[model samples]
Target: MTASNHPIVGILLLAAGKGTRFTAAGGEGNKLLALYPNSNGDQVPLLAFSLSQAVASGLPVRLVTRPDEMEIIAMAEQFGAAVTLVASSGSGETIAAGVCDSANWAGWLIAPADMGWLRSDDYVQVAAALSSDEAQARMMFDDMPGHPVGFGKGYGAALSQLTGDHGARQLLDDTKLVKLAGHSGVVKDADLPAQ
Candidate 1:
């Protein structure tokens, strides 16, 4: 969708986590940089997979990562996403920074950087929910809630106020939560180097 048609909704790609588990699982490489062969037989970085999905959704994208991750920034930029550097201490800080940067957006579709399997249509569904009046917050999941939750402009203030390790969980509890059909990729994360 074009910005003019859905001026309120924006895509926020959260990639600032330290990936401690991944480092432990492997040696020193950032899990996002880990290469995996796709069905096409071409090796692709884990982060690029997620980014490709985001771009396919056709939403304006903003990538959030730590200042030191120039590689991540370059990769995201190559995929045509605007990049923002934020502290990687926790999800709360990274999300808050993303929200602060997207303050002018009417709503946001937040996606975790590691969720490589999230389909483009999944994002489309969440964005569609945000376009509706009843969806204050939309979560994508099957058996349970998962990543890439959508938040309307109404919660921008609360999202911006987030601190510490807290995320949008608190806001979801306070607003009208809409649960969409689950996508298996939503639960997939590069928790380990081998994963």
Candidate 2:
């Protein structure tokens, strides 16, 4: 795709975090590497599923991962994403690195790496909202703002200011946010494995 199509919104898929919870649950290594059973009853790599969605989205995608995560970086590259290796800093730093040059796009879509179950078209819908007049937008599932949050170019400074676990949430205050209704995948995130 040309820059024109992706000029509206770029996808920032954060994957640098060490999945401590997953490791604690008797699952070794990164939770992203843990095999999860899919709908078809076939085990799939969590990161791979997530990476494939970002690739199928057709948006200009950047995968932010730790320098040690060579496997994840390689997989991300295979899916046609610009992979960026960070210092394994906090979530905020990972995001900042992913959107280092925000001026090229109208907005940035913050998609967490663990949210792989979201449908491909969901990415397209969220992106469409960014190109509109909305300065900031997010998926609304069950009456709450959820993941895959899209922030317009006007919030570039705030985005850049992110440093810890904080993300675009701080900027939502006192601002009109466009909420697009989405399914469960919009809010679903892999925190701890199921009991």
lDDT of each: 0.81, 0.78
Per-residue lDDT for 1-195 in model 1, tens only?
855655567789889998888787763678888888787988899889999999998887889999999899999999999888986678888888988887877788888898888888778888888755335545455677776799888777788877777677777744467777776777778887654
Worst 10 residues of 1 by lDDT: 131-140
Best by lDDT: 1
Per-residue accuracy of model 2 over 1-195 as CA lDDT, tens digit each: 966754567788889888876667676777777778888988887877887887788877888889988888888888888887888558888878777755577788888898877766777787777755346777879996677888778777667768887766677743567788999888887777744
Residue 71 displacement in candidate 2 (angstroms): 0.8
TM-scores vs. true structure, each candidate: 0.90, 0.89
Question: Distance from true position, residue 189, model 2, in Å?
Answer: 1.7
Cα distance off (Å), candidate 1, residue 74: 0.3
Q: Which stretches of candidate 2 lie over 4 Å from their true place?
A: 1-6, 101-103, 132-134
TM-score of 2: 0.89
